[model samples]
Target: MDFAFSEEQEMLRSQARSFVTDRFGAERVAQLAETEAGWDESSWDAMTELGWMGLSIPEEQGGAGFGFLEEAVLFEELGYGLYPGPYFSTVALARRALDGAPEQLKRLASGGSRLTLAWIEGGRAKLLPETGMSTQAQESGDGWTLTGEKHLVPDASAATDVVVVAAGPEGLGLWVARCEDAKIEMDPTMDRTRRLGRIIFDGTPAEQVAGAGDVRSTLERVQMTAYAALALEAVGAGQAAFELAADHVKTREQFGKPIGAYQAVSHQVVDSYIGIELARSLAYWAAWCVAEGDERAPMAAAAAKSFAGEAAVASCERAIQVHGGIGFTYEHPLHRYYKRAQWIDSFDGFGSVQRASVATALLGS
Candidate 1:
């Protein structure tokens, strides 16, 4: 079996890398981090022109007609560049949940609107906190109204619509609420490059996209895809950090010799490399499994997410240590990568949560 990416996938990867490297460099990311929108509108327009938002949707649906593998390739490049935008929340999370809503999907594919999933409730620090969700969707005269508070909504301020999971007459379901109706307050976080918003809905009008019977399956699919994408992104960041640290060690001298000549620095770099490579392999495997709808996809995603998240954080920390005092300064780009790794590591759920899921699958829970 061929484990390498196909020629076409390689081309896609190269193209994405070129665009991200040229347009979304460290300085550009830093500048965007200071903005209220947290992204450049012109650059986002360029990405829409490039058809990145529709990479995984079917051609019939006005997308690139590719699979999750192709999306994985693009996300990896985005992660490497640390592109400060809602691409992950919009494309990876919101788009997946909008499968049943053609009009919303069309808007997303055209980049005419930005949407984000609002599932985290009560400021809970976990993924898919369904049981703890207090959001209620009450049936009204021809529509629904949502009343509750959602915390840590990714890019909520930038989103035009929110895909919210709320309990209704039929039970738990998915609803699309217009952001204009919801009270949104942007919050400051360690990862300045990304934005998180606290959203409050008070009898907000919404459109149901999925009923109770179908909500679980849809959410599961979205969760798996999110895990795969985030894992791949983590791997990309880890690889970049490793490369940077390796280069630093090779040139920086200590005791009249390159620090890389010493066993200690070389060993740390080598360990980081090994971790990144292992994480990459798992990330790719998870993406392929999700794309192919394999039976082991859940396990694969859990394992990939668990390991890759930690590995990426470790790689960033090691890079910082290897760079010595300079790495600790805020001016260094290493801090940005480290912050991103930390953010991704904690997003959805921490490594421990994913590892527990994998353990349950293996041990027969």
Candidate 2:
């Protein structure tokens, strides 16, 4: 299927790129990473004013009423910019995870609240298990009490709310809880731009949402959407790294000529460029499948995620190699991009897990 962006979508991309270039440059991102919140209030407010948080939300739910495709366009630009904020956790993960909760959806669309997901437990990152979930939810008066710890929850400290998946007497369910009510400890990670948290819940109050579908099915659907969004983000990062390397090779002199003039350097750059393009195509296709609710979305998302992640990492590595020792230094911005790509590639399901998912879809589970 053709995944060409509409004229309006292209315009959005242009606008987003301009915004990122002006407001979210590497310097700005680095500055934000040094802050306590790891983001700028003004920048986030500007994004909210632009209706980005509501881009994929339905109109009836108090959003701009755009589809996932438009959101994907914005996500790629955000990735390229290396945006440091909870936008990914709020929109890409929480919004998609809690679609059945209209009131919370409205709050998110309006930028009145920020929510993140807490699902991975005890180093289990591949899939949400049907059983043996450490977090347990017990029925309380008019609500539920969640108990246990969640590992590596993105933006937990920054979010106002958290969507926690826990096992209950009725099986697993999605529960919404106040972030303040839980013990949130930020973990030191390679990607300081995007914060991760270790969240512990001891008799924390929560309200269940998304009750129509089976819990595993709902979680799987959320994961598919996340995979597509993350793939596109990785593609953007890869593109940025490639651009940086391409520009560097053309300018940095060696033997009184540009280093890019050498076939050894030029060939590597060309290979990276080709990989980014391929990853971009697959990522966009996966986004399209998700937007259309196509039956093949699972397979498409897995394949796109698996390939895009590797492509992005390879691009970062090649960029470093081409830049020589400077790229390895902390002062250079290339390392930041590399760290961000590595973090995203491992979040939730890594490349190997995604590839296994694709294999299962193609070969028979």
Candidate 3:
């Protein structure tokens, strides 16, 4: 299939880039990171007002009526700016899960409610935790009661509702449960920018909508959404790191010449350039798959996430390397980009996991 983004998609990309650039420059993002909340409320509100938070929502639900490709572009801009918020967890995975939940679409689309997916368990990384969840989704007169614990729920401390992926008597349905009633507790994280919470649901109220089909089938769809958003975010962060490094190389001097003149530094900068462009291609393509409703979106998103996530991490590392001793310090912006990329890698298995997923797709189970 042809991989070019249509003019309309390009327009959307430009608009989103402009919005993020104007809203969260290096200084401003740094400023926001220092706050107790570690997220920029003003910028988050601006994104919601611009319909970015619900870009994929249908117009009937008071959204932009756009599709996934457009959303991918916006997310790349967020990554580029390192826009701190629950944009990834709240907008990407939670929204899709809620779409399958009974009567939750209206609340979610209106931004009157927000949700986070809780799948992370303790000390598990580099791959999805295989530990069986303990959540009980037993039938009730009204609906269902969810009782269990989910650790490392992004933004759950402030969410209105949470989409709990649990084993139910019938099958796996994205169970929607009230957040305030769930007895969630916040925990400190390495990033310290995005809040993490551990939630305990003691017969908490829930509404379950059986997925379009089986549990695994529904989860693939959910993962595609997450992978696509991470790809876009990678594109943003990689490009930002490259820009910062490039400017520094031109201005910083060594041996009576700008560092850009040195082959050692110039080559790394060029590599970063290539990495960003390659990652960008994969991200946009994955986004197109989602918008066009192609069945191959899962694989496409995996490819994009793997490549872009790696590229972002590598680019930030090179940025710090090129910045000399100052890059190692906490005061440098390179560290910020570096930490962001590390979080992305740790949270979503690095490109290695995607590579394995791709291999599985090609070779079959």
The top-ranked prediction according to lDDT is 1
lDDT by residue for model 3 (19-75), tens = 767877777778877777676656556677767766777777677777787777778
lDDT, residue 32, model 2: 81
In model 3, what is the error at residue 56, expressed in angstroms? 1.4
Q: Taking the tens digit of each residue's C-alpha lDDT, what string does model 1 give over 281-300?
A: 99999999998999999889
Per-model TM values vs. the true structure? 0.97, 0.97, 0.91
| Higher-ranked by lDDT: 1 or 3 | 1
Supply the global lDDT for candidate 2: 0.87
Ranking, lDDT, top scorer first: 1, 2, 3
Error of 1 at 214 (Å): 1.1
For residues 1-365, could you state the per-residue lDDT of candidate 2 as single tens digits?
45589999999999899988999898888788888888776766788898888888889888988889999998899899988878888878888877778899888888888889988898565555646577989889988889999989998888889998888777778899998899999998788888898999999999898442567777788888888888988998899999999999999999999999999999999999999999999999999999999999988988998889889999999999999988889888888888888887896667998888778878988
Better of 1 and 2 by lDDT: 1
Error of 2 at 337 (Å): 1.0
Candidate 3: list runs displaced more than 4 Å.
1-3, 122-132, 211-213
Better of 2 and 3 by lDDT: 2
Candidate 1 residues lying further than 4 Å off, grouped into runs, are 123-126, 130-132
